[model samples]
Structures are given as structure tokens and as C-alpha cells.
Target: MHIVFVFRYHIFFYTRCSIPFFTNDTFETQGRRHEVFVNKTIPMVVEGDDMSAYSQCEIYKTSLNTSYSALNMPPSNTSTEQCNKWVYDSSVLKDTFITQANLVCKRVIARANANMIYFSGKMTGALVLGLLSDRFGRKKVLIISTLMHVGGAFGSAFATDYIFFVAMRFIIGVSCTGMYSSSFVLGMELVIPSKRVAASYMLDMAWCVGLYILCFLAFVTRSWDMILLVMASLTVLLFVCLWIIPESPRWLKSKGRFIEANAVILKWETINGKKALTDTSSSKNTKDDIEPESVLKMCTIPNLLIRTLLIYLNWFVIIMVNFGISLNVGNMDGDLFVNFAIISSMEMLAYTFCFLLLNKTGRKRLLVGTLFFCGGACILSVFVMLFFDKSLYWITLVLSYIGKFGITASHSIIYVWSAELFPTKVRNSGIGTSSVVGFAGSMTSPYISDLGKYVHGSFGEVLPQVIFGACSVIAGMTSLLLPETNGKALPETVFDAVQFGKKKADDRNSRLNCFYTNDAFNKDELTGEV
Candidate 1:
């Protein structure tokens, strides 16, 4: 009797949920409905016995010998207003900025412009906050950035118009850059040189986890306003957590606050279960004895200038290709949610793979290889799309996934590489400059992805793919000029950066031995006098 009751309940539930409602009389009516333009006005065609209003309208139009037009119709000045309506697939996003702003079809450009504006703000923020972090302190800058982000997120959720929403996104973008740059540099400073890769991996892991969590939240909440509010609250909560963390010891020492630096180091030593260094004077001597140089010197020196330029260029290309692929995933012909989930899952796997190979393969080899791999896959996906039938869509999807994996892994490597490439004094400056320049790529990436629509009449959808792939390939070859800093100590001064990769084998070995023997003193050495 219990089994019979459970079976009946299951049957009833399925029958109730599976019942279909037909807006069009025939199931195949979906394929026949079309969008037509009459006198520069576009409207959706509604047909079938189920649509009585549309059928009546058709009879009225035929009786008057006039065409059916959704737009440019006579205005109804009564108590109610009537306008043409569109049916949008609600599974992908319950409500997006575009949907809320009423930016459909002809007004789609506005949505793209909003995305571009946010990245432009990121460029401005990188320039401003980079210098602030160096001069003020990483922790302070991080806290300020977080507060700004929280404020921007809240502002965005309550935005009254499309322009207001765009402006808020720009504000959020600015704060995000500050938080990103400061937190990364600070995390690197807190760990040993050998363990920096592990530290970077942890940060990447957190980002990937957040991405998946966001997807789940969007699915559950299904409201753009609610989503933004939740994100803002979380960032505010993280700001409170930031108070428990200390300022970077290296940054403190750089500012000549030796006592505070030693206190922070001692706290770290206690946490690590290691003995605190008795000689704090050695750290003071290291800083006071060495003559500090100006940040401008990085540009004056030829080797430093060339290295900085190369790094900046590489960063720009990597980010361009990365975001290009990420944003375009929606345009691909598939279930939007499934494609996004697949891409996000692949990124997580890429981070894990990168962590495993980073120490062994070294930075340069991995960077060069991944760029080429990404570029090649992008180009190949286009080729498959053009030459093959629609039946082979899975092949194109697989190639795109491979490309995303390579780009994601490269992102992880570049952060650690850029931080190591610059000296302590100007490290933030270098990162900020590279990030600012890289923002150009991000700013243009939306338009690049949209190239398909503009040029699809002349060239096929392959033009955007060609541009994305070519940039990746070119950047990969150019990356060969970069100096390898895989297992080496982070440069502490402009002179240290100038001397990077120029040392003899014996000198390198000697530094490595000393680095291992006294890890605490080595920390002082890595930061260069500070």
C-alpha cells in the first residue's frame, strides 16, 4: 500500500509538471515565426489558432488592405498603452542589465559600451592605486579599495537608469583593480621565494571557487539586483576580515619603520613555530647602508626599460585574448548555461594543472607554450566552424575549451612573473603600469568579440577568431625575450633588476646556498636593503 501511494504521487507530479501550454497551435509553429521589417520597423509575427488577438489583427489588416506592423503604429491615447512585445529565453539570465535597461536588438550597442566603460575605469584605477599602494602601504590601499568596491556594488544595484548603472560599474572596476594589485603583491611578500607559486595558486583557487559560487547564486536568486546586493555584502564582510591581517613587513621596512617591521616578522615566526631572529639591527643596517634609488631610474636604465616594456606588452596580449574568449562564450551556439559551466570548470582544472607544473617547467617555458597553445586552439576552432558541418559543433567546443584552459593557466603564471620581475621599491609601479596598459586590451575585447556582427556580411564569423588567434601567437613569440626568474630571488633594487639573468652560474649557486642557510636574512636580502 505504501509503494502504491509513492508511485501514485510520482505519477501525479510528473503529469502536472509535464503538461504543455501551446501559444502557437502546432509544435512546429516556432520555426515558422519570423521577424520582418516594414518601412524600417521590425516586429515579431504571431500565427496560429492559439493566438486569437493576432488572428483578429490579421483579419482587421486584410479587411483594411494594410500590413501588420509592430513598430510605428498609431499611439493609443486611452487609459492603457499597447506596444509590440518580444519573447526572450529566460534560462540564461532571469534579468540582465540589458534586459532591465530595455536594450534589445537595435539598442544592444549600449550594453557593450557599458562593459567597455568599466574596463576603462580599471585602467585609471590601476595607475592611481598602484602609486598609492607603494607610497602609503599595501594593507591600507587594500582596505580602501574594498570599501570602494562595496560602495560601488551597492550603487550599481540601486541604479535608476542605464547611464547610472554604467557609471557604477566603472567605479566598481576601479576599486577592483586596487584590491587585485595590492592583495597579490602583499600575498607574495608574505611567503618565501620558493613557495610563491603555492601562494599564487591559493589566490587563483579562491577566484575559481568564487566564480562557481556566483553561477550557483545567479541560478538560485535569478535577479540582477539581488545578485549585486549579495556580492556587495560579501565584499563588506571581507573588509572586516582584512583588519585581522597585518601590513606587509617589506613595505614597512621600505618606509624605515624597522621596529614595526620586526614586530610583524616576530608574529609570523611564532605562527610558523620558528624562533624569532634576535638581531633586528641587521635588517636596519641592510636598509640604512644601501642608498635608495628613485622609481624613475627604472625607465632610465636600458635593460630595465626593455624588460618592463616586454612584460607590459605580454600582459596586454594575454588579457586581451583571455577576456576575448571568455566574453564570446555566450555567442557560441549552445545551451548558454552549460557552456558557461563547462568553461568555468575547465578554468579550475587549468589552475590545478598550472600549480603542478609551475615549479618544474619554470615560468618562461610554460608562458611561451601556453600562449601558442591558446592561439592555435582559437584559430583551429574557427577553421572547424567554417569548413565543417554543424554536426561537428562539439569539435569546435572542445577546441575553445582547450584555448580557455591555456589562457587561464597563463593568467596565473603572469601575476607571479610580473611581481618577481620588478624590484621592491617600484614593484607596485611596474604592476600598475602593466595593468593600466593591459586595460586597453580589456577595453577593446568587447568590440573584438562583436566583430563578427560588423564584418559577418563581408567576411564570415572567422574575422574575430583570426584577430584573437594572431595576437596570441605574436605575443607568445615575443615572450621569448623575457628573462627567466623561475627559482631566483625576487629583485630588491633597481640594480638587482638590472643584474637579473646576467650573473654567472657560480654566483647564482652561492646566493642560493645563502638563501637556504638563513631564510630570515634571505627575506631581507630579497627585499633589497629593507
Candidate 2:
């Protein structure tokens, strides 16, 4: 089959100054003040100036130039060619990525082994980067994480022995986790709240796109070592991208670089073609409104702790299942590259569907649905293996893929939920904690890979399958009683999420009844105010 090929990658970047601590909030006239994910519409005060304001103070500009295949970073054999030529020979580059299906799969296993450890770092990164961003600014942290990720990727690719590879992979895991958390936090925090959900979703989609590209590479490349090199080389371009992006302006003011913050906001607004809020004059005197509480204390707020813990558990499980199935596809006699690619395709669909339905379905329902789907699939997997020869292998393969789909959806959306749960003070803390847990899960994936080694043939794999199935069940059950966040705003205190969907239903109905009332018989009442 002819594959339509594409790839998505980000260049490395960093904050120029130290991230500042948030204190005065006078300049953020925007609604919704959750840290990590804040209101995107009314523009949060950055450097004490109107963030969305397009003009007035002008030291910079926020412009997004998406140059298509500009540098054409592909495999060594393929040279930069025309778009049509590239498309026709799409399989060429993709094959390079997959030449070592066994190798790639093994490396994926190796990567997952470090995943749990890596995820642990992610959780810790929120506080570290948050503090760093607030003290120095986002740009520098971004750069640091990006370069580190590149180093890790290349490091793992070139390591001479299994131990070195594992250690480097762990380092790669750290870089990835840190980069993922920092980039995501920065992206959402900088965007308008209205833009947040979509932007956040887009960020995940980029990873999916990256996977798609990886699959294509798998199809094209036959060499494992070169594939690693190609993957590592893909990120080197981030160095050039650093020239365009800037520091997190909010972090600047938090760090007392009031003028720099204001200047940054003014530049962003200019690129977006928006006028300053209430005149440019208010920009000069604005400051952050932050308390002195530590990130951990922020997490201890009421329901926040419970929600974060459960969510982390859920994250840990999902990552396990997601990578577990992918890494062990060989046990099922499935083509690792094609199966991995197909599974990723399904994940893309799952995420898209979830994003569309998330607000309408409520977090609890969506989350539960995912867990149930995954659990059900895993439970069915045992049957498929038991009946492997009777057309059941195909069914099992598809079933396992579905399990991946469900968990991927949950994994993708959980970050948004975390962002909403905590207040500005501990928003990063909560997310960081969850990230650490999630990364921990990823780290543990490698060890789980060993599960396949113990299992012999058809019957041998049953234990692994059964364990995976049961884990899903537990995760699903845990989700059943957890809080559901839907249309309602993210709660500031832990107590807010404790009530779950009940609160959202009541609040939603009240608001609708009052504002969107059926006017058939209440024409007079409706016009009373007028």
C-alpha cells in the first residue's frame, strides 16, 4: 500500500533569563486564573503589559512561520527533492525507520524500560521548571530541555553497550519528560484560555504526527542504527528555531523584569493584531498576583491531592498498557512496524474523538469510558491467545490495538484535567506530580518488556496478557468514583472536584435555565428586563 508520509518535530529552545516567581496579579485582567492553564482570551499580564496588545510598546513580535519541508530532514540515502517526488517515494524514507523492525521494537522496549524513571522526572520537572520559568523565564528552560532531549536521543542511539544504552535512554527519558512538561506548560500558559483546550490537543496531535512520521520511517529504513541517527538528527534543527521564539513573558514579571515582560506582551499582541486592553498605559504598572506557598503545599489543597494521585495511577497504567502491547507485538506474530503504525493511527482517531466530546461528556465519563474500553479489550485478549489458531489471532491483534486506542485518549486528555484541577500557586505542582508518575510508568515499561521473555509461545504469553487485562480492570474501577470535570471551570480548592459530575450538572442546568430559557410561553417574562 502506498503510504502518505509526513513528520512533525520541534527544534530545541531555552529561556534567556531566570524564571520569576509570581507575586502581584494586578496586570492580568483576564478571567480564569488557574496556573499552568489560564485564561487565553483577555490576555494575562506579562511583564505588566497587555499580553494580547499588538502595538504601543514594541521590542518583539510573535509570529508563527510554518515552513513546509524546508530543510527536508530525512534518511541519509534520500536527498531533498520536490514535493511530488517526495510523495511518490514516500516509502523510501519511511522504510529507513523500520528496517530494524526487530531492532526498533527492541529499542522501543529499551526506551520503555527507562520510561518509568523518565516519567518520574517529568513529575518533578513541573516544580523545577515552574520555579525556573518563574525565576528566569520560559525561553531558557525550553532551550535547555530541548537540547537535553537531543543529547539523550543521540546518546542512546550511539551508546556502545546495553548498559550504556539503558543509561543514555534513561537520560533521554529525562530530557523528553522535562521537555514535554515544560513545553506543554509554557504553551498553555501563554495561550488565551479559550485557545487552551484546542492548543493543548494540538500539542498531543503533534506527537501523533511524530509517530506517523516514525511509522513511515519504519516502512522505509531497514537499518536500526541509522534510524536512531535519523531520529536524533531530526531535532538538531531546534537550535535554529531558538532565534524566533522568546521567553515566557509572564515569568519575566514574576522575576521583576517588569519592562521586559511588558515588552514581550506588546510584541505578541502586535503579531496577533490585537489592541491593548484598556489602553497601553495600564501595561507599565501591572504585576503578578502570586502567594509564597510551595508547590507541594499547593497540591495538598482538599480534593487536589486525591484527584492527582488517582490520575497518576491511571496514567501509570495507561502508559504501561499502551507501550506494553506495542513492544510485545512480536508475541502475537504481528509485524511490529505495521502494527505499531496501525495502532498509532487508531490513537489519533481516539484523541480526536475525545477532544470533540470531552466538554460535553464530562471528565469522569470520558475517563471511565476509556478505562472500560481498555479493560474490556485486555480481558478479551486472553481469549484470543487461548484460541490463537482459530481466526482468533487477528481478533486479538485488533482487540489489543483498541485497548491502546482507549488508553491513548485518556493519556492525551489527562494533562488538561490536571491543569484545571490545581490553582495558580500549585498548578505546576499538580501537573508535575502527575508527570512524574506517568513518566515512572513509562520507565517501568522496559521491565514489563521482560514479561514477554518469560512467556513461551501461545500459552506462554497468557500470563502477561492476563496481568495486563487485570490492571486495566483495576484502573477502570479506580476511575469510577473519581471526580468528573466538564463544562464547569477548574476548581481552585480540592473540595471543588470532590462532588464530580453532580456539581457540573447542577451548575450547567442552573445557568442554562436562567439564560437560555425556553421563551415560548415566557415572552413577557423574557422581555420584562427589556
Candidate 3:
């Protein structure tokens, strides 16, 4: 079953059972253990710039709370009626236009590629940025790619016609691919050991927040072109970030720039109030504290190849379900944008809950549990739509939402798991390739979503459900073949990867070595070694 986290204002109600906000504080007569920190200020996430091996990235901010609260409006005092009108009417709500726009863009772009016009400039852009970040640094890549994304967003926004708009969207896709991939890689390298998985999942959470932010922006704005213009204007943030962002010292050290990397680590410690490790150190406080193995070329290893395949398939699953449910909503009688926003908010909540349980539950249980429920939910949805009366649209919708909830959790698992699966050498390349495969799946979604529009057969809904259901089951089953990475140090090479799941007594690798981490540049105090 999909576990929904309903956070209380210290008061939890499980739909039926209500638990009051009971805390055992210092002054408690009953000697309860709860202490309320209401109105207490949490430390702000240090928002600034840093360069990783490939490029200089300026992190905007970070949060530890992965709960639905991340998507929540911080107790805004706005009246409900006032907020509703703006939310519905705003330009930010125009994300609904994207599906239509992207479809139009896809049709146009397909033609150019067919004529051998080298249409996949986005892939080229992605590769170039990947290498650029690797060679020049992650910080520079951040600045440049953000501009590329902004430019693409603007061009797509103001596209005069289908052809032009499609072309701009293509450009936008390329830039976004570059920015998204580069940012993900850099952000992982920036946080402490324990914070990694949560932070990684937060990337998607940020996407959700982006939608809400767009919602707010859309409310305040009017013109679609103006929205694009505003989006473009948001890129100007890169310039401001240049001052505060630090160069990726680890990347510098990886590229044989240790002195600079050391300086950067010192700066990180100064800002975060943690002790910096001497060059090449790591702590072992928890399993998460264990460092990642080095990256190796993806094509060179057998397990690496299999893992890549798994990652790509999972991504395809995500695209299939994400767009399928979303496009499914458009066929109904509702404000499509609001519905999509609600779905996005729900996805954010899924990510948040996953964050809380990820460490405790481990990856295997979560993946399996989510997938099994996802398949069941899809199957249930079909029956609801078939045997039930028209009055049950609400029920069918709930089932679909449940399926979405499952797929969203599965989708998140794919990204972080892929990262963990790869060695440092080919980590980016592996993910990059997986992304292309995922995009191939993504590119096909519109067509898949359109299948039922004019068709008479059950192929539209039934086929998709069957396919998704089968995929979910198969994907979950495949996870069993993979080893439990929980608390285990990442292996640096294919040899180590192959040997990872062997019996305890058969262990050749000490499981305690530095393996594949940037130990000298680490600041994970939890591990204590660093």
C-alpha cells in the first residue's frame, strides 16, 4: 500500500484516529519525552556557489524536511477566496499549455531530424555541458547552462508559430537537459554523507516547488510571452551567484588541483560550522557515511551494463506513468492546470515520505512495496473504469492517483539508485546515457498519451495499464537481483561491484577501505575519518 504521510501540527490524525500534540518536555510533570520547538528558527541552508570537478555550481538553498511541507505555503495569511482566484487565473498556471506546445514542437522537430538535419542538438548540448563541467568545472557549467535554459524557455514561450515554437522548445529541451543533469551531479557532491539521498530527492522536490512558484508567478502575471520573459529574467540570478559560488575543489583535486580543493573544503567547513578533514579522509558513523566508489566507464563493465539497463527501464516506466496519468486528467472535466499542480504537489509529498523512510526501510523494500502497489492500483483502476457506473469518476480518479503515487516513488528510486549503482569514473556518463534512454521514453510519451484519443479499442487505457502494470512488477522483481547497498561502501570498479554481493566469509574487499570516494576533500563528520 502507498503510505501517505499526514504531518500534524504536532497533532496526528490517521484519517480516523486523532492523536493530540503530546510532548514530554523538560517541565512536564509526567516526564514525557517530547519537547516542542514552536517558532524556533531552523538554521538556514547555506545558499551560494561552488565548483565541482566539471563546473562551478552555485547552490540556491537546501532543506532537510522532505515532507509535504516542502510544497506547502508557509502559513500564508491570505484568504481562501482571494488565493483561489489568483491561482486559477495566473499565467503560471499555463503549464497546461506545455503538453500541447511540446506536442506541436515534437511534430515539427521530427521532420528536421528525418531530413538528416542533425535535429538532436539537445543531446549535443548535453554532452558538451557534461564534458565542459568535467573539464572546465561544475560552477561555470551552472552559470552557462542556466542561461541556456532561460534562453530556451523564453524562445519557446514567445514562439510565433508551431514551427518556431517547436524549434525553440527543442532548444529549451537541450539547455534544460544540460542544466538538470549538471546540477544533479554537482549537488550530490556538495552535501554531507547522510544528507545525500534526501538532498538528491529534493531535486525533484525543487521541481515541484518550481511549479508552485510558477503558479504564484502565473497569478501575478498576465501574458504568456511575459511569462517566458519572466522565466528568462530568472536566469539573471546566475550573475549574482557568481560572486558567492565556490569552485569544485574536489573536481579540481580530481583533475590534480589539490591545493584549491583543500581551500574550498576549508571554506565549506567555515560556512557550515563543521571540521574539515585533512586531505583524503572519511567517517563511518552510519552506512550512508560510507563513501561512493570511483566512477568507471559504463560500457566497460558487465554489471555496469546491466545496471544501466535497469536504470533506463525504470526511467521509461516513470515517463510512461507520469504522462499517462497527467494526459489522462486532460480528458476529464476539470481545470487541467490545477489538477496537474495537485498531482505535482502529491509527487512532492511522495518524495518527502520516501526521504524519511529511505534510511530506515532501505531501498529494496520501498521499491518493491511501491511497485507492487502501483501495479495493483493500475489493475484496480481498470476495473473501476470498466464495471463501475459513471458516478464513480471520483473513485476511478482516486485509484489513478494511488497509481501515480506509486509510480512517483518508483521514479525517485530510479535516479538515486542509478547514481549509487555507477562508479565515479562513469557515474556521469552512466546517468547521461540513462537519461538519453529515459528521454527516448519521454519523447514517446506524447504519442503514447494520444493513443486513446480517437481509437475504439481498449488498447488506449487497457494496454497502457497492462504495460505499466507488467513493467512495475517486472521492475520490482529485477531489483531483487541487485545487492543491498544499504550501509555498504560503494565499490570503485567492476571487480568490486561483482564481488559486492558475495557471502560475508567470502568477502575479499575489506568493506572498510576508501574504495571510490574523494576522501581527501570530504567533510562528512559523521564518518569521523574525514
Cα-based lDDT for every prediction: 0.68, 0.54, 0.55
* Model 2, global lDDT: 0.54
lDDT of 2 by residue, 307-351 (tens): 566777887787777766665543344455676578778878887
| lDDT digits (tens) for residues 1-530 of candidate 1 | 00111111111010000001223322112332321211112222343223412211111122233443365332222122222233333445555555456554456467667667877778978889988888888999899888888888899878869888888888888898998899899988877777788999898888877777666766677666777877777777776669777998766666666688788878877787776543445443454223454556788878778888888888898888887777766556666557667888888998898899988998899988998999899899887978899799889889989999988888888888999888776778678888998888877776777676577442547777788788888888887888898877666667666667765434454433221112222635433222
Query: What clash count goes with each model?
Result: 0, 70, 47
TM-score for every candidate vs. truth?
Answer: 0.80, 0.64, 0.69
lDDT score for residue 263 of model 1: 88
Q: Please identify which of the two predictions, 1 or 3, would achieve the higher TM-score against the true structure.
A: 1
Range of the 10 consecutive residues with the lowest summed lDDT in candidate 2? 8-17
Top-TM-score structure, candidate number: 1
Candidate 3 is scored at a TM of 0.69
